[model samples]
Target: MTLSWSDPMFRSIVWQVVIIGGFAAIAWYLVSNTSTNLKARRIATGFEFLGRTAGIPIGEHMIDYEPSINTYGYALFVGVLNTLKVSVVGVVLATLLGTLIGILRLSRNWLISKLTASYVEVLRDIPLLLQLLFWYTVLQGLPAARQSFNPVPGVFLSNRGVKLPALNWEAPHLWALAAFVLGCVATHYVGKRADRIQDATGVRPRVWPVALGLLIAVPVAVWAALGAPWSIEWPVLRGFNFQGGLTVSPEYFALLLGLVIYTSAYVAEIVRSGILSVPHGQIEAGGALGLRQGVILRKIILPQALRVIIPPMTSQYLNLTKNSSLAVAIGYQDMVSIANTTLNQTGQAIEGIFMIGLLYLVISLSISLFMNWYNARVALVER
Candidate 1:
């Protein structure tokens, strides 16, 4: 028996097949045209160019890289790492700062509310690129190495960069790190158990104190047992510069500053909206039940607010990751920057573009997937 056109299921299946077939046909046409164009121009295409030596110098790299020794593929990998580093750090810092500002925006104090509002308006209104340029210029205009700003004995700042004392780690540090990881896992279980107990009984267990003991006290105890396998290596003034410390270059600083500041503005708005989306009656209800302000916020407001907050927050995170491509403007060696160099050097525009797009697609999808999962967990379950 044939399915009737009037049937909703039959119509739905027909529409889906038509859409899929159309997409497939378009994809085939595009791919065929790209191949034909490459062939016509006698241009070589493949991933073999990745193995060739990249003779260009890069300012900053997390991994061991030398222009004379490493391949183009390695350079691309370094770029990916740099992008991830900035994106991760920017996301964390932005979220924290933005959340604070958002909370302050709703403050009972007039000064705080006005100040936060002004900050949000200023940051979001200014173009991110211009802000980056301004920061870079300001950093570059700082005093020279000889007249460097010394905020603390071991910390120095100048036109060159900011240098802080570096931690020298020993083998035992690994064991300390392992202990810290174990403590974190224990804390997570403890928190879950606390929540379960709270649900079963009317009394909520105080998990923060226990969590702090596990996460912080246990780590400290492990570190002491391991003979504190670390030393601070302070920056010392060499002939014209500071040496032997952790350095933050101006380019990286500018990029990070701009990303955090700009993204935080948007995040503040998202957070404010999320918090406001929660019904005021909920707060009054909590107060009626003899709950303290902090408890009400923690147990009620945040859980509900986070469900609204996470989806848009995910978009902001992805935007920050993608906007890291702006690192090229400030001479930061991010993925897009390195890929641009590769494309120019080898004249492999297609490959470079494809790689950059693929990397971004993977990153965006990963963030979306994670946020979606978290949102689902915290979301309201309706019967």
Candidate 2:
């Protein structure tokens, strides 16, 4: 007998259902057995313990969190904040420095190109953890407070860390921050308008003038109008230590420096490759049209190269953020450091590890999502 297309025999639906059911049964069995075994071993489960007191001090909390009063959840929040603080600043600085180096690596000047190449190679070859340790050691070896290196009258550098002038923010400072944010938004829109103008009329708008006006001029005007509510408190060597300034702890500095240097090497390579990926014909054509080298680079190459550079750079940023967990190695009191302390003090290994994993996952996912949006904006459409 021949089977028709609609025949039940022709479909594998029943078999598919059976296979899925079998897998589900196995999973259920495994879970049940594991739970029983854990219970027999007197191991606890669930996240109810998160509400309990953490009873561990987090040394560098941005929020008002005390070990005696705060819950495990609050402690985790502090850790997350510290991680973000290092990661965000590191990402911005690394990208800026790396792109400059990468562009330099492609320079016609032999010395500049070779020097950048050497920097990328040398830094990339060393382990990041080792680099962190090295930086920490260097900071530790700096002269004591009495003999601290003073690059400026207000700034002091010692084994403890760099002490720089801290700005005391007042009402005017809030206005300045608001103005700065507005400037960034305005610059973005200005760039978009310039692109549209270029597309329609082949005329490149002077983006720098507009950008400078928005970013600097507007912010300065607002700051001046608000009477500049900013006071600089400088560090002074007093009583065997520096006092009255923003002290960047050695651990924090070492971690930041290590993360920046290590991640910058990868970012530099990404940028160099992205720029090189741009067709030489495009540059020659820009030159043929009487555009200066700087104009060609700024108006043509960078915009195109950014699309290619951004995705991989995003991965590097994620790596840097994750690698910051190694801050525990040097006692930085980052999330991992404090979390480990909590685990030791409370004997809550499972809860601590889960918290650490979840915090990292959230950070990683957020960065990835933002990068995706940016990538979508910059990605080219092909016919």
Candidate 3:
């Protein structure tokens, strides 16, 4: 049915069209102006510059990136990898530390609770940039190589960097890793079967112990069968410094430290609020049903609290990811820093900024999608 010109719905549609057209016109103006300005200044634009060689030096990179041999594309790829490395590790450590501090904040012990509270207040209140600079300073101010701080026999920290024992892998290590993967698949199947059994019999089977045994036993048996083809490559003190082990650069260490500490404070608050959002009557009900404290916490409390926790947790994760761009300040070769260098070298400012924003947008969207899927599974759905 067609609506009359005087109908309310027809008027509403006309207004919506007008608003959208206005927005489109504004967008067109901006783009046209930008193009004109670029042409006036004779500035190069477009993504083709990515293929050109990047003569800039990157101090720390996950992949092989020689300034003379690599293209801007390769350097950007290394930057992306470094960004992911720090973001992933920072998220995990922040969540664990945050959960611990959150739980401690609710502890009955006054001193423990106060200490955790103070930590949250101090860290979260301070600017994250300041914290990053402070941590970088601390790491860079350590003793020189000859007088390096040796926390343990093979582990050393100094102005040079942090060195720890590295893994020396061989053929048997592959076999052992394959066995471990198989064990994980088996364990998942076993857990599903156990859940089915519980639904039918009202008795929960001891699945975790069995799964743990399979994980350990299968890996060990495979390693033994293949003669345990792996060894620890320990760092050794050579002429002026230690060598032969894995070294974490000061920039990375500082970036990780700052992000984890700062983000964890906010995560702690989110966790605490999530736990408290559960009704007190539920805890009393669990106790009355003869469930132990651990069982109540694990089976009842965590499941409900997770629904509230995950959505906000996703936000913190995205924040941590974007904040990783701050690595440029301390000379860490993250994607943003590389993009900036690329911009300077090629004089392609617009293309460089677009690529940096696009990379971050992709990362944020990926995390958001995964968290949304998980949240759907765990959310409280009314029947």
What tens digits encode model 1's per-residue C-alpha lDDT throughout 200-287? 9968788899888887888788889878766889998898778898999999999999999999999999999999999999999999
User: What are the per-residue Cα lDDT tens digits for candidate 2 across 1-383?
Assistant: 76565778655776778899999999999878977876898887667766888888776777899888899878878988888889999999899889889889989999999999999999999999999999999999999888889988888889888999988868877787798899999899998999899999999888998889888888889889978666888888888788898889898899999999888889999999999999999999999999999989888998899898998988999999999999988888888887788777666687788788988898899999999999998787668
Q: Which pairs clash in model 3?
A: none
TM-score to true structure, per model: 0.92, 0.87, 0.95
Sorted by lDDT (best first), the order is 3, 1, 2
Instruction: Give lDDT tens digits, candidate 3, residues 343-377.
Output: 89898888888899999999999999999999999
What lDDT does the true structure give each of the candidates? Answer: 0.92, 0.88, 0.92
Better of 1 and 3 by TM-score: 3
Error of 1 at 365 (Å): 0.4
Q: Which ten residues in a row have the lowest lDDT in candidate 3?
A: 44-53
Full-model lDDT, candidate 1: 0.92
RMSD of 2: 3.3
Better model by TM-score: candidate 1 vs candidate 2: 1
